[model samples]
Target: MSAAREMLCDTARAVFAEAAEAGMAPVEAAGFDLLLVPEADGGFGGDWGDANAVLRIAGVAVPDLPVAERILSGLGDAPKTLHAAATVGLMAGAMGQALALSIEHVNTRQQFGRPLGKFQAVQQSLAVLACEVAAVDAAAAAMAARLDAAGLDAEAADFEIAAAKLRANRAVGIVTAVAHQVHGAIGFTREYDLHRVTIPLMRWRGLHGNDAYWAERLGRQVAGFGGRGLWETLTARAE
Candidate 1:
């Protein structure tokens, strides 16, 4: 990340942490609602990359406070596709937190006179969880880039948005299962921090759109492009 973006994320981390305690008031006071608007329009003029970064932090810190809605408010009458793309970023962040919490639990919780992290089964579960989290993170990043490249036009970035949301939705079952499995029954308790991330991830999977919805939408877009056109378009978009 660039220096500016690093600073932005740092600020987001702090602001979101406070928002978690004080509700949307802290987020609104921080001006995240101007995240995607242009400076000429009396806004921050930050791109989707900036919004993605802030949203990811919000995903982990203030998952229930309408952070995504506030951030996307800059776009009047935004399409569902854009909201779906934003949800992917939030899911990615929450999934990442799930993995982090799972790892922390496994390393600390003891079983059979040894730390759970020492067990092969626990390690394997964590590895799988890590892969899913990485996939969602990659999908979210790609979607954000496509949205930025398309000037935040939902129609132009529909394919990426669909794919990202589908990828995130698909991973939810595996990620949450593996995270909770590794953490055992303690994960289900209200006192644990694991619930903070896992619950939001489950909620986000159905928010914006669900797995089947995005899967079919993605398939239609891919079929429209056909085999060769799909590859060409993918490469062209990457370029």
Candidate 2:
């Protein structure tokens, strides 16, 4: 990562750690407003990218909060549905799902009277789960860097964010399904917290734009770009 991106990520990690440890509520509006304000307005004079970095950091630290809303606002009223699709909520929900399943499978199941987690299949699934969570973290950070660089065009950035969200959306389903499978029938029980993550995944996946919606958006955006438009503008500008 570039120095600037690294600094932003570090700042976010510290802020999130403080919030989590203190059990603080998310200050959505205040956080966004602080970042959105111009230097003259006593703000950071930052734009969407800075704000996006803060949101992603917040997600890494505390995925439960609605940081996606703040990020969506940067895009204007593209559509409420589209806005909902902008968050990393699906990704967060995936992590929660995997964790829940891991806990359940470790406690339940039987193999030689031992829990299924002792088996190689379960271990491999767990490893993949870890990888998925890491991918979300990295993708979110990379997107934030692109936003910060001002190298991406507005529409292009929106599409990129959509793609990320779309990936997360699909991942949530895969993770949750695998989790439930590893967990077996017990996972479907409402008594378990697995539902806590799965329910949110179901809701979040459709929030902004589901996989189908964003995929279509990306398709249109790509086809619409003929060549020397936004890319040219960004390239021509002096850094």
Candidate 3:
């Protein structure tokens, strides 16, 4: 991460920590809605990279809050795909949290006079959880990069948004399952923090775009591009 982005994320974490206790009121008072506004317009003049980083923190800290909606409201009007992009970031964070909890539970929970992490089956499940988290993180990062390159135009970043959200949506099932499996029945308890992120992840998968919704839309987009044109467009976009 760039020094600037590291600082931005730190600030986001602090703000979200406050929001955890006080609710969205602190978030509004902090002016996160102006995060994407232009500097010339007396705002932060930030881009999608900044938004994704901040949203990641919000996802981990305030998963139930409307932070994505608040950030998008800064634009006044934006393409629906932008919500998908924002969701990828949130999903990445939530998946990461799930993985962390799973690892901790496996390391601490005893079975057959040993930690669950010592067992091969538990290790394999944790591995799957980690892989899913990494994939979602990569998708979120790539989507933010593409969105920034496109000047935050949701239409221009539509393909990336769809692809990232779809991958995240698919990962949600595996990640959540592995997490709960590793934690056993304790994970499902209403008093446990595991549900904090897992539930939101489930909700988010269907929020901006469901798996089938994105798959069909992405298929249509690729069909429009054709094989050769698809390769050219993808390569050019990477540049």
Model 1: per-residue Cα lDDT over 84-148, one tens digit each:
88888888888988888888888888899999999998888888989988988888888889989
How much lDDT does each candidate structure score? 0.88, 0.60, 0.90
**Root mean square deviation (Cα) for candidate 1:** 1.0
Tell me the tens digit of each residue's lDDT in model 3 across 158-188.
Answer: 8888889999999999999989988889999
Give me the runs in candidate 1 sitting further than 4 Å from their true place: none
What tens-digit string does per-residue lDDT give for candidate 2 at 132-230? 766765555555555455443444456556656766776776677777777778778988666656666667777767889878876776567656664
Number of backbone clashes in candidate 1:
0
Number of backbone-clashing residue pairs for each candidate, in the order shown: 0, 3, 0
- Name the weakest run of 10 consecutive residues (lDDT summed) in model 2: 77-86
- Rank candidates, lDDT, best first: 3, 1, 2
lDDT of 2 at 153: 41
Candidate 1's TM-score reads 0.97
RMSD of each: 1.0, 5.9, 1.2
Top model number, lDDT: 3
